[model samples]
Target: MRVSQTNLAGDLLLNLEKQGAGPLHERVKRALRLAIREGRVEVGTVLPPSRQLAADLGCSRWAVTEAYGQLVAEGYLEARSGSATRVRWSNAPDTDVARPSARQAPAARFDLAPGLPDLRAFPRRRWADAVRAQVTQAEFTELGYPPAGGHLRLRRLLAEYLGRSRGVSTTAQDVTVCTSVTDGVRRMCHILRAQGITAVGCEEPGWTRLRQVIHAAGLEPVPIRMDHGGLRIDDLAGRPGLRAVLTAPAHQFPLGTVLVPERRAALLDWARGVDGVVLEDDYDAEFRYDRRPVAAVQGMDPSRVVLFKSLSKTLSPALGIGWVVAPPRWTRQLHQTDQVVAQPSTVDQLAFAALLESGTYDRHLRACRQRYRQRRDTLVQALADQLPGAPISGIAAGLHLILELPATVDTAAVVAAAAARSLRVADLAAYHATDARAAHGLVLGYGNLADSGLQEAVRHLRGAIEGSS
Candidate 1:
């Protein structure tokens, strides 16, 4: 067998030929596996057809097929019923090896799936430093039950930070820290329900988890459509018994449309007119790519808008540190809810406060924003090159983009094909409350993938979409 290697600038190449190996299939299988493991055949890449690849390597198609079959069995390759074989992204053994019944293993290779940050870049050293400093200098009573709201230092820092960055005017007294946005929304709904508001107007294609939370709290969710500028405000002009509305005005979840100035004013006007509350989930406002982020609606009408933001998208969700700044009217009720369900960790709050105060948090946000913008551009270009006819949307901000496919393509089928290739992705249709009139597509998240990984993932994504179509 003759094996040759070429060192390309960005990619490695391995050429294998069968010589005196016991069997051609065995030789090809070993070579393919080596190429994949050694970064030759990168993850989320489509392998050549059995015949073409065999011909290139001077081997029989049977040998290539057999080798591919073996690789598939070992989770390195994926074979669709009628589609060509491709390298499985999930075959990377480092992160996807062990499985616990309770939790699913991470995806094999390029996880373009949405709602995750770059896990590799977490600031462990800085956090550890803060933890050590807090432990050494803290009062003995710091570890006790947290204040009904949250850590005073964090609250004060967040008050100033949110005002400057997100334009949410508030005092530390109005800020109530919770475990996550989900917890905050649930508590807000409970407070509203108690106030005799049995229904909340939710965005039609809003975060599914928020819908569940509202439903679980015995509140009916009235669906309102969203457009490029923001939510369809006219739909909720005079709805009765609608006590509140949950909206992601900063960047509408999944769709990524910034609420325009007119709609923002209209939403606040509605709330003021109806004496209703608006739970503004200001998720990912700081990661805007095109323009400076629009101010929070809370700033326009703080009395009616309960603003929520967290480190989930900015820093990491695992930090479990988020806060809701409501008007003084609802502060007491929110505090009572926090007391009953428990507040976020004191240690995490203190550590985050230190990060924010020391400017580490701002620096991290700037770095991530730059990196994510590049990644987003890479994915967009790849999709344009591969799926040229597809209508692309939501590329302006945030970590993900929505690629709208033709009506002839089955979204569910594409999702299954992606899964078969061990490439995790989310179907855009899945995020809608009702059937959407737009073409189907997948939401691709580039935040987690490095430059190489982003390109490869988009390549594999194109192959999967093409194969399914």
Candidate 2:
């Protein structure tokens, strides 16, 4: 039952010598554990037999046997008298748990519903290199718990990058790193609550999750309706005690309308009049295919607007790294209040800083812009060819677009039909706070949808609409 050296690639490649000062058996265990944790060895992979591994490591048979025995007891490996010792645990988190019914929906085959980027294009190697570089070069003290406001180096780089790219005028001192837009909204809600604010204005046909976040954070989300231009400023006019608003101005979510220049000015003016703060969730502003992306509202009056941007759309949500550029007053409050919040690791922050410093982030953006534009174009063309006379909007910017369906068509029925076909699509009415019976539109996303399946997906969608209608 002994496995030979040639049975495994690199002969179980354990660098026991570099595992620091320890007993031979303990060092062997450490090396195996490191390999398993790093995903260099996969779950269910059979380890070389004790004698073979011991010979490869130039260690005693007792060392290998004891290491294997310890790992087996720790639930990292499994061994039997007659069978080979194999990995029992995987590096991935345990997601198979009892959850609420609402969180247990089956995944659709073709997910066209919005709010995701092409995860297939994530720069794994480049990111890994950056992580490695930061881990090796970072100061000894930097490896500990990250600063409450995040790593200073990343904050500075983010400040400069946002100022240049999104026209957000701010210094590093004003930048407080947050986990995501959701995290930023929650934090801002708490901050506003501290300021004795009870209500916050949110777009009616906007991201539902953020509105829920606001509610969860103990703030009433006042639904302000939006049109083709953007959020209706008149809605903010007479709402007493409402001193804060969460908005995605550059490219709104679900609706995907860029706030017109006049509306932008009006929003700032409204904020100023009420001594309010505009929590700008700069969502999907990076992937505008039509023209140059709109400058952030924060740049116009940083005092009134707290800008939030993240790598979620541009890079990947898995990064869990984003930032908030607030006025000096809010920035001070944010840092002071961020005591219990879990900060992103210092290594990730520094690695992202490295990406920015080396111009890799910009290059990645350029590539994404080109790829997304093509995907958008292909999807648009497919939709046009399949469903003529169907008014399509929101295609000028962002990852998703709006398809205006016939007034007689049932949006809910269309969604059900699409789901039946294993092609997921969103009903526009779902985005609105109030009943939107008249809003018969389907929100289709081209971001994560495969380019190869564009035509086929559109065909299935057409069938869904036809069958539903």
Candidate 3:
């Protein structure tokens, strides 16, 4: 019995092409196993005869037969003498595996959690086009195992984009592409460790992941506090043996205070004085709604500063494509560590580069800015009308803004109340790394929410605050 066509399970499409890294027979076995595991290939479904499958795949019959034999032995499929192979795998996972249980949190009705962009505004059509173009027109070399650094076209394009847009002084030779901001920072920490730097200073109320990444690289992350002027450079004098600093100078995280001019100059001077390196995170600097844009700290002194940015907030976090502009000394170090720590695939890199070249990425950013601006405006007005004189900070820019409740209101109480009501709002203390807490407030993100949505969210949040009192 010959089955010439590829097997299809109802309306489910099987991507025989996604035969991920392995030998041919193993790839075939893995794909079929996944289909069964995912319930696409239902139990008791008979697989195509090996000879027919081989002819359809343009492979030898023996390969298909061997793959089927292995799957049968693994208990994913059952085969008998003179019988067609049938799926044995079930949709339900095995209860025998002692998996740790976690209490699932209630889903928020209106989530204004910071550090996330409006996913609804994601340019799906443009992104899909970019992917299609990449797969169709990418060079044959790009289809093979990607180089340690990244795809050369993407590296060159990113170098150009960052230099022109962010004033980052870098060339393709100096850039290293990784999966995320933390990945880039982790890589830099390892490089800094090699430079005899044992400890680094990070903003006290900074990105929580920064400290974790720093610790993972076997370096101590000293908590450096920030005022309205951004990270306190004077505090650096107290931390002994600290030679590196991680900062979001353009628009500080959670707090949203841009590093003042004096502190910016002082930071560079301190770096020069101590021969220290500054790891600058350029996360969401593109969405400054007010005030003049601050140039990247890396632009001030590229030799001493490493710049990191990702498409997470700008485009989508799902892409997981981030770049690092390291100085010449550190650029070479990436290659050394990258061998032990594997890098992301070249497929998405090509797609991103296509978006960059066609200017689709920039257009998407402009549209998102407008949509988010309206949402932000709606939330601000609602907050002003409902709870006048509420201390709202970090509103001048970024997808999220900070709303400081009266000190009388217990931050935890409001959070619990909000959770109980299915309204998700994050507190400022959550961003603090040290034992000392920062300002107590809700970090409200309006990017993913609509103008109508914000009115409802603010109402729920205000109720939470009132309930706390």
Candidate 4:
């Protein structure tokens, strides 16, 4: 290990100061011993030359030599004829080797769970180039902690990109950068709670994590029934106290139904009628396979809707970046609360902004859409050949599709059997907020599954399903 010579000298000097009423050599020896025992000087760390260390510590060379000699004798240091004195002792136990986990279930070989994207398709080279460029060219101020809301450059680019791409009407001033969709939702729940909104309406069968976030935020999550058209606006009738609602308008999760245009207008009208907010989760709107992506509902009325988007699906979750386009009222409070919160590093934000400005992000999305569409088709074909009569939906957009099993089939048993075969899948009933009987199927995600092994994976999944049934 390469230890900093200057830091080593400083540590020894400090340790020497702590030693009381002792001879110079003994004090030096005590200091070195203490430094070694406390791991301040880790094993394999090459120390500064005795003469240089003596000069730095303002001590005689003999004292330093004597201390080194003593540490060597005590097995705390190593001294070779041609080598400088180095630490050789360690108090820490060896933990470099990995041990197997005791979990009873077999490790997943193929992941069919929803919400995961084609991780292998991430633009690593382009992202690395952007990161390197941003880091080298960044200003001193830009390298410091980011603003509470987010880095200004990323916010500006996101506002422009969203407007041009998704028809989202927003400005940098209205965007609040967040870590993820869950973070954005949690932040909104707090804002909504502060505004006297005690409850929020969510889709009947929705993403479970966001519902948990809303509940944890001390706000009631009312499940609004959904039909094929998407969330039934009529379900909002009885909940007079529900001032806010979260919906993935472009592609509702689990069901994968796009909110029809009429319902979109009606939903906005409902929000306006109650003087409430529409928490629009622009989920999987980026990876549509059939036609051009649907314009964001926030475009209809920005004043009444708050739009949330994240790079977790488009790029990778490892980046932990998302944004919120809020109405002016909520925007003001989010800005105030976020002043005390710091976002992702300015370097990451600027790099992502650079990725967008350079058109690399868009190009990456196009490639992903093509790749995911092909993968989806392969999975669909395999399912058709194996499970002939099974109904699948939500295939027009996003990385996953719904495989509706027969009413006689046990969804839970299918999931368990899939797991036994090292094929990870989720039960559709788990995503429902209230009615588990409403839907029974598998949310199959093909994004990250390897193309070469996909056919075999599906064969195994088919066997699992048939066996379970």
Worst 10 residues of 4 by lDDT: 1-10
**lDDT of every model, 2 decimals:** 0.81, 0.85, 0.82, 0.85
* Global lDDT of model 2: 0.85
In candidate 4, position 235 carries an lDDT of: 84
Candidate number achieving the greatest lDDT relative to the actual structure: 2
Off by over 4 Å in 4: 1-97, 100-107, 338-342
Give per-model CA RMSD: 15.5, 9.0, 8.6, 6.1
> In model 1, which regions exceed 4 Å deviation?
1-99, 104-106, 338-340
Candidate 3 residues 388-458, lDDT tens each? 99888888789888888877889888989988888788878888877676577778787766555677777
- Flag regions of model 2 displaced more than 4 Å: 1-107, 436-438
Q: How accurate is candidate 4 locally (lDDT)?
A: 0.85
Clashing pairs in 3: 118-448
Model 1: colliding residue pairs:
1-19, 89-109, 90-108
Per-prediction tally of clashes? 3, 0, 1, 0
* Model 2 clashing-pair count: 0
lDDT of 2 by residue, 1-469 (tens): 2222333633556676678887888988898898877877777778888887877777789998999999989888888789988887775666222222455688777879898888888899999999999999999999998887889999999989998999999999889998888887788888999889899999988888998999998999999888889888988986877788888998987778889999999998998999888999998888888799999999999888998888888889989998889889877778766567787789999989999999999999899899999988888888889999999888888899999998889989999999999998999988888874335799998778888777889999999999988
Backbone clashes in model 2, listed as residue pairs: none
State residue 13's C-alpha deviation in candidate 2, in Å: 33
